[model samples]
Target: MLYFLPEPPEYAPPPRAVRVPAKLSVRVFPEVIAMSHPYELAPTRPLSFERERGITEVRFQGGLAHVEVRLPGRDVEAERLVLLQAVAEAGLPVLLIKLHPGSVSFALPDAAIAERAERLLLGRGYIYAMERDLALISICAGAMRDLSGVMAGLYDTMDKAGIRVAQTGDSHDALFALISGTNAEHSARLLRQTFGLPEGGTSC
Candidate 1:
């Protein structure tokens, strides 16, 4: 059976904090931010490395532990070797499943170890991007008398488009990702139609 940790003891403080407010203002602001899509892990894939001049970059994929590294010059290889040795000495056991110019990645059997390794590498200034793909739409309009009505109208519009929604968050913002790029237009169309919004409603 698979094992799980309820909460991994905070390896480090969270990057940011959440704010709570008691009262709301009428002044409205329109802003949009992309919502990340959920992605499944492909752990068996091996890591790869690239180098140009004195710069090196490494790429590896796994659970939440996607990794990428950049180093200056041909010294990248040597630097990676030393870094791995140091981690091992710190009592952090990781298997060097792959090593290439500019980077190396470990295949850890435990999620806790993998997460710690990821944070350590990131804290060292290694460049990495999470594997999340999402499309988020935000709308701002004069305050509606009922928020529930706003949501109903939006969902009905999406429903007509024959799009299957995985999840809908409780916010004026709409977050949904298409299965394919070809469906994006359809999804956007559905979204606009639902909200009675005009094309190019949002500024670029």
Candidate 2:
């Protein structure tokens, strides 16, 4: 699907990207190019390894869950505050959140918290859904949103590898994808291979 950077006054410039050829690239990320246009994935930043782990260690964090809600309100910020308050009261750790027109999808630390969330949020002018056994994967880079084909390639990689994504969110700084906890390792391996990064850090 058609998915959605800056700065010239750099302290240090970003590394040149490795280009995926259109022919081989399209086979890998066919969903990226819908129209007859051309784009390039800018160079990746050569990571500074003071204590950097590189792309190895396909790590997956467990004990995560998500909650989706639809409430009628124009003030997104106000709604967010309300949701955060409710989640906090439930003793669940809120991870990432995405807001649509009147709908919001957010994640918590554990599935058991759903009981508190539903009890607290339901009948309070909101329809909500809660899910558990989820893992979050996020990639952050400078100006990733502005880079064309990057997201499409990501989705394509998941699709080919048979990774089922539970939810996705994006901001100016990062891209987040939630997948089955069981599939986290496979998905992480696919992500590492997709980016041509070195493997073997700690876990997968």
Candidate 3:
């Protein structure tokens, strides 16, 4: 059995950075399982499993943008209010969001929404930072939750391919990874292969 050691939140390691490689290692697992099982119950060498493929799309949401809202005095309630207000101003939904010390980062559909969000929040005495040219890549495989290793292997494939993931979200039926427009085509191609999908699956 594998054992793990815990680390303090302050000292927790940052997420791994993936790089582009000429080829991905087909061997996802580095070590073999050492188990005392009956021969009849043992698994096959090259295991074959089933997976559901989601309708994957790499949408360019009208010039991607991210706005960072500073949390005044660590007042979490105030932060929530600011976010809700921004959403109302955008007239569109947020693509993704992340929180950091004294601030929260949001991925919006376009520069227009980001600009509007910033102006609205600024009027309320909030400080923020903004960025653009981002995108949303969602893998909508309904079989994601039902199967183990589907998501893991997906990430592994991406990591091996050197795809840069900015923000991400997932549900039982889907997975999402945020990236820049420059990486969209490559990311789409790799994801297509990762899911074992035909060309038709990569459309819209």
Candidate 4:
């Protein structure tokens, strides 16, 4: 978690020079002033459409698979640890890990790793499900941590566009969602338009 203190209503004036006693025979100087407060010094101007929307870019990554492992017993923590260790031992790199009441889910970079992970789980008698041909769409912003309604707006746009999101994640600067690989390009285009981003703003 992070906390942002409000900027002071007014900038503090620079310090004045102070006099030293003759007995000390020392000259005292105020510390050099640092940069001014951004809130006070920044220029005031109308924000561009994209800047106002806060979204800076849209990114896509294709050829990923989503997997979920079900922990059926009472010790879900132990089960989760063992499952993760098994994946690590198999040398499968996972992303966007999420925990549910009885299951843990993550994304694999490619189908080969997904298949290998599934085989490992099956051999270890762990129940799981895997979905292939998924693409990750990232909505990047300058201040996502402070933005409101961005996620809701994103989901609403996707719902209207008939894009079904399989998994989601977020960070201080971006939001991520996994959708069908077939919809990757279209989803990126739609999001760019919806957020008022310039054409060709997406990168893979």
Which one is best on lDDT?
A: 4
Predicted candidate 2 versus true structure: per-residue lDDT over 1-204, tens digit per residue: 664334456487688899987775332332343345356543454546443323333345776888789766778778877877876766766667777677778787676665666677874768777778888876554455555665776799889988877777766655678888888777777777776765654443
| Deviating ranges (above 4 Å) for candidate 4 | 1-53, 202-204
Q: Assess the local accuracy of residue 145 in candidate 3 as a C-alpha lDDT between 0 and 100.
A: 68
Candidate number of the best TM-score: 4
lDDT of 1 by residue, 108-155 (tens): 434576667667767777654322222333333332322346556556
Question: Which residue pairs collide in model 1, if any?
Answer: 37-133, 54-73, 55-73
Q: In model 4, what lDDT does residue 196 have?
A: 83
Q: Write one digit per residue (lDDT tens) for candidate 4, span 17-117.
A: 99977686654333334448743333334545544347789888899999888897789898889889988988899999999989999999888888888
Ranking by lDDT: 4, 2, 3, 1
Q: Give the Å error, residue 172, model 3.
A: 4.3
**Superior by lDDT: candidate 3 or candidate 4:** 4
| TM-score (all chains, Cα) for each model | 0.29, 0.56, 0.60, 0.71
Q: List the residue pairs that clash in candidate 3.
A: 19-162, 20-162, 54-140, 54-141
Task: Report the lDDT of model 4 for residue 183.
Answer: 98
- Sorted on TM-score, best first, the list reads 4, 3, 2, 1
lDDT of each: 0.46, 0.69, 0.67, 0.85
Give the residue spans of candidate 2 off by over 4 A: 1-58, 73-81, 88-91, 123-125, 140-150, 170-174, 202-204
Better of 1 and 4 by lDDT: 4
